[model samples]
Target: EAMLLSLYDHACFVLGHLEWSEGMRGNHYLACIAGLSVAAAYFPACRWTAQLRRWCAEQLRIEARYQFLPDGGNFEASIAYHRFSAEMLGWATWFLNRTPEGHNILGRDREFWLLLERITTFTEQTTYRSGVAPQIGDNDSGRFVSFLPLADDAESYGTWHADPHPYLSQRNHRETCALLRAVCRNEEHILDALFDDQTQHRQACFYAHTFGVAVLRNAEAEVFLRAGSIGQRGKGGHAHNDQLSITLALDGQEVIADPGTGIYLAQPAMRNRFRSTRMHSTLALDSVEQETWCEGGGEALFWLTSDRAHARIVAATERLIIAEHTAWHLPHRRVVRLEDGTLVIEDFFAAPSEATIWFHLHPHVRADRTGEGVRLEMPQAHAILTASGGATIMLEESLYSHSYGVWTPTRAIAIQPSGTRTQVTIRWQLRS
Candidate 1:
């Protein structure tokens, strides 16, 4: 009890400092209040504990309402980070519900309870049946628990002995899902309503509109599309220039994949490369980034000029997702349709301009340039890609990071318009 009280005091001292910036408010704020709340509950009788509990109650309410959209998607926009923040909130939820004395009115906080249920749903929907998560934005591989402790004082506050994979791995994600399932209960069931891989709460399609992400899954494949605001109310600290990007997995193997975050501010050049527009599977204005301000620099490694992408999904359904963005002031639209192992992507530009479309593949997936676009092959699957609209196709060497600090060589397919065009269409047909 004494140790907990001492920890609470230190937590308060740190959290009491001048409010965090807008970008930090998303995950960092919720985590702070959650820690303080948990520590305060250890000895609820003390006057100091009472004060901490009240402060945490009010602060938690604000954090939940602001950081998580009604659709349960996190505004920070990184699935890995969402799991990190959810850990803090989930424990808070369970504690408040079970510990009657320390919750400080949170037991009856209807909004708090509702948000947890929603967050849980969104997290599950975004997670693949393989238990891997999409690297939509910056993924520093943050998580709630670790068995491996930081081994060296000079390792810069990281578990040097930790496994290469963080929240991005199947094992890590499953642990998180199990934790979430324990606290999130629903009084409903429809057989096969969710992913066939699970008995309950498995959804074939999930639209987190407020967060600009739409997911579609069938027996053979899962398609995830990004079309939404850069998170943190456009401050975009963890945001990526992935507006209109696509991540597709066929039969549990990634073909067109997002380059998972490799490292953070430590490697400024690598950091910028991983988040740059070219790194995503999307069209860019001849190499120009969706967020122009993020170009050509290493400083402010955590900052981005908000709203530059101005991307959003115009329409979405289980089979189709259509979204548009104005990167470099050129209006562009991408329409993606997926069904029965076949997919079509249509890129339309309002006016002609030099541009390129890149599709990064998983390291395990071999590829070769075809007369049209490229051919993609994984363990038990093969795909043929063909492009129209007068673009030369090229297969290039690239890098893919399954988790933080580990990278593997991969192949990337690029579609470069010979000159300029108003429209381009690429089709991927998958076969066993």
Candidate 2:
């Protein structure tokens, strides 16, 4: 009772003088609202507690409508961060359901419940069969809470304690799933499938137009395309210069990988390179970034400003998806199609421009150069890449980070068309 009273007192103080960031409506502020509401629910009968819970319920409803898009993607545009914010929302839902007063806030909140279900579905969709979430945008391994016994987050400027294993990685995605399965009315079996690393999925392509991501899956492989906006309403704090980038998963392994965020702030140079357009599996004109990177400090530490790309999907279907973005002062269009178990990617532009295309191999994959392209040997499959344009393929050293503050040396296939190009069609054939 005393703990409850103390929390109630603290909630009142916080409500009286709230400090919201002027920059963005991010999870940092929403988390505080969720925490204060949870505390108020513990003493629902107290007058201040009652008032605080009402305010939190209203604010959550308002922010969640904007923070999570119609398809349930967190507007930060980072998949790892979705897990963090979803956990906070799920936690608040669990406790709020327990109290009669809190019930008024949630029981009839149909829109909120639908958002939770959508968020849950998104988590299940984006995670790979390897049990890792895509390092799509910025993956700093943020977590709302760690229930594990030995989990400790590595600081941006400190020695890595996330050793021997990625305990600090929130990409496992099960924690958020577990909470939603219990409280969000999503089917338990769906969440159950994610926990076991089910290697296969239902037969159909999936696309979230609201999030601007497209997925193509077969019995043994999955293809993901990041063709979306510079999220955070163009602030780009957590977004990357990864427009038209793609990743491939085969037999539960990430064969074609996106270099996850290297340590931020501490190693600013590495951070800049990792988030650069060149580090992604996409085309960059004259080796320029898709979006100009924010360098140095403060907002530059996270923001990817000058977001004029306006990347988006032009057309999509069960078997084909096409997207384009105008960055580097040119329009680059990518067409993704799967035929006869081979993934075909075609890039098109109107005028000739010096262009470089990158396909980053997972650290575990073995890469060898061939006259036509490069051959990739992954644990689950072997694949070969070829291009229609004249290619000068070079094996370049790259880095891959699965969790915060940790990275391993990898190799990338950097393809520079023999000359400035107007069209480049790259295709990959995978063999089991």
lDDT of each: 0.71, 0.73
Write down the lDDT that model 1 would get. 0.71
Query: Where is model 1 poorest over a 10-residue stretch in terms of lDDT?
Result: 186-195
TM-score of 2: 0.86
TM-scores, all candidates, are 0.84, 0.86
Q: Can you give the lDDT of residue 365 in candidate 2?
A: 82
lDDT of 1 by residue, 174-195 (tens): 5555555665552123112222
> Ten consecutive residues with minimal summed lDDT in candidate 2?
154-163
Model 2: per-residue Cα lDDT at residue 202: 37
Best model number under TM-score:
2
Query: Tens digits of per-residue lDDT for model 2 on 1-432?
Result: 788668767877776766576667788777887787678667747676567667777777777787899998889888887778888787776666666666787778898888888887887778776456678888878776655322344442122221354344456665566566666753335335334433323335777776778887766677889988778888888888899999988765677888888878788888888888888998876646778865686558687768888788888787788998998667888888865557787777654347777888777788987866787776556777776666567899988887778887789987775543423333444453
RMSD of 2: 4.8
